[model samples]
Target: MAGSLWYATAAPGPVLGPLTASVRAEVAIIGAGYTGLSAALRLAEAGRDVVVLEALEVGERASGLNGGQVIPGVKHDPDILEEMFGPVAGSRLVDTVASGPDVVFDLIRKYEIACAATRTGWIQPATSPATLEVIAARVGQWRRRGADVELLSAAETARLIGSQRYLGAWIDRRGGTIQPLSYVRGLARAARGAGARIFSQSPATDLEETHSEWRIQTPQGSVVSAMVIIATDAYTDRLVDPLRRTLIPVPSFQVATEPICDELRQTILPEGQSASDTWHLLRYFRLDPTGRLVMGSRGTFADVPVAVAARHHYRAVREIFPQLEGIRYEYHWGGLVGMTRDHLPHLHEIAPGLLTGLGYNGRGVAMATVMGRILADWALGMPGPELAFPVTPLAPIPMHRFNQFGARMVIQGLRAMDGLARVRDRWSARSAPGLSL
Candidate 1:
């Protein structure tokens, strides 16, 4: 099987070469994912000289490896965000998050990016009655904000999702899906078109700051710029040790089946939307443009083989859609998601003229694109107070080394809890008088 179905199916990407000599620009960005490329495009279009150095080819990391769900907003709802960050800051954040999908779709249109972009919506289904309250609460918050969101009854969810297991769901119309790798690659093409210099295979190994400028050293060349942006999310390194420490990079694994029969394709995700369930160890699935069913979940440790790692997802696919039994899985891949102590995305001004945008906590497609634009705003001289996201201190996570073990344990416990809850919910429903499936 292909390591990544996206890679196998993606159109030819832009040809970007490695850096061979030192260059100077107004701003230098590290990492060539959505964040760096988006920031580069904006900065370059603003007539600023920008240089982007990437250790690998564009979208080779999290940006390319993600599940391609362009979901807007963070894990928290708008009301909670406002409560946590105070009305003013939180409101700004809410607005920023709400517009994330807008930014992504706009870019795709403005740049004419071809990634099989779809804006049908994103569905978060309740696996059991216990999760209905949470889903309804989330729907209520978005509806109160006058957002394009709605709650779906169990029948509607089953019809839309082609799954009778779900009790209900909530959907955000602002959410969508994309060919993640192609999207990032197109961003690189657009950024270059806007006059940005991008170098693939150019790792920013050393960073030194003088009185007014920052110098980044790569394997074959270097970049000297007035300001620097660290856009690496889950693939962070020691280039900024503190920044690296602030993230818990967890692997997210995915599997894709060969194109299903047209009948199955029409039944599953028929509205062309994607879905993620409410399980503690959540399961997210979607249909690609080719009709392949893609399923994703939190990954096993690195040493596990792809087939072995895919056991859980295979089981999930069977339970979620028994009709897909005996389908052939054509691909498997994984990437890291940078989780912060606080599930919120952070924008940090590390020091004067040195800045960074935080990880998206798995909401990278739209959020990362917006974050890149935010980084560009900072580089364009926007004050920290005026930026959409609040600039907070970068504090390393405590006992971060043990996060992997904890993540594993959490996954196991959540799996057990979700299973028990579903069993109980099924029993209660069966016992309820006059209730029918």
Candidate 2:
């Protein structure tokens, strides 16, 4: 449990040197993660001269360190989305998110990204009957919209998951998994091939509007462009104070076991599908191409200790797959997730020539990729009403400086609630002999 397993194993790609001198482009993108890289690729394909500025190497932050679970839909359900933004806008949002995975896999294929991409599907298991109801409703809503999603019965869920811990589950064939770091690097490669320039280790220290153009100053050089994109999700810096204050950054910790024996792999996630439970503090697990079992969950914002946080993930793995009680974990790491108050991705025009997008909650993998295209479209003069996500004014979150403390409290409270729910679920199962827990 030390560094990122993705970076440790994935094959390296061409590295872009840092910005060395002043450059001019039609569009300058800040941050070289999924969103920024994707926007760069699309813009380059559209024949726009674009330059991407990265603080570190590409995919060095949340983009490369994420769970790599390619889930569909917004953070919330379709019905909830409709309720939040009304029927027309909500349905449009739902349609956009539902197509996210296609955008991801298509890029991988078109670019020949060697990220161990898998489209086996994604599963959401329900640990209790109440959660099962939620899954059922979700399946129904998605199915009504012609998505290839289905609700599994208790026996079917157990068979597919190789665990009796869940009462039911929902499966979306559109979802998948990938080596995220490799995917991002491949995107950089493709973007470069399409004539976009990417500068690594170049942090944008200052952003200002000069006349009708945007000027971004880096330590080594500067980028002057007609438009700029702040695609720096959870790792937002002080340069974009308004965008930074609009969301809370929460950490997600992950641990992966050494590749298990083929026999053991057959007994866990046999279908090779990624899965997560329906809990306030959720746990997600998947099998890498080499059979290593990877799992992750919510973590603290403050640096209390790594061993303390790693223990929770270890306990969760053991609880689900009892056969691997003493499995040796090979990697441990965490990354920040930009969570918005409404738990949906945010797209905004902070000023006339400056635009920014962030707050993917925990669904950054697919959402971020889709957001890049949307951002590129916006930069190409697409109207706000025609965009996938609504473009709104940037509003700072109230008391954002104290958000870390609030995040810690919320994590603790959710953990307690989850524990209590498990206890109550077990009690109810014992009381009603025929009931499924």
What's the TM-score of every candidate structure? 0.95, 0.96
The candidate that wins on TM-score is 2
How many steric overlaps does candidate 2 have?
A: 0
Off by over 4 Å in 2: 426-437
lDDT of 2 at 65: 93
TM-score for predicted model 1 compared with the true structure: 0.95
In terms of lDDT, the poorest run of 10 residues in model 2 is 428-437
The models' CA-based lDDT, in order, is: 0.87, 0.88
Predicted structure with the largest lDDT when compared to the true one: 2
lDDT tens digits, residues 111-228, model 2?
Answer: 9999999999999998777667768888998998999999999888888887888888999999999999999999999999999999999999999888899989999999999999
Q: Where does model 1 exceed 4 Å of error?
A: 422-437
Give the lowest summed-lDDT range of ten residues in model 1: 428-437
Residue range 1-437, candidate 1, lDDT tens digits: 14999999886678988999988899999999999999999999999999999998999998898899989888887888898899999999999999999999999999999999999999988876756777788888889899999999999999899999888999899999999999999999999999999999999999999878999999899888889999999888999998898887877899999999988888998999999887766789999988999999888778777676699899999999999999999899998888876777789988778899976888888899999999999899988899998899988887777875676666667667656765675522211110100
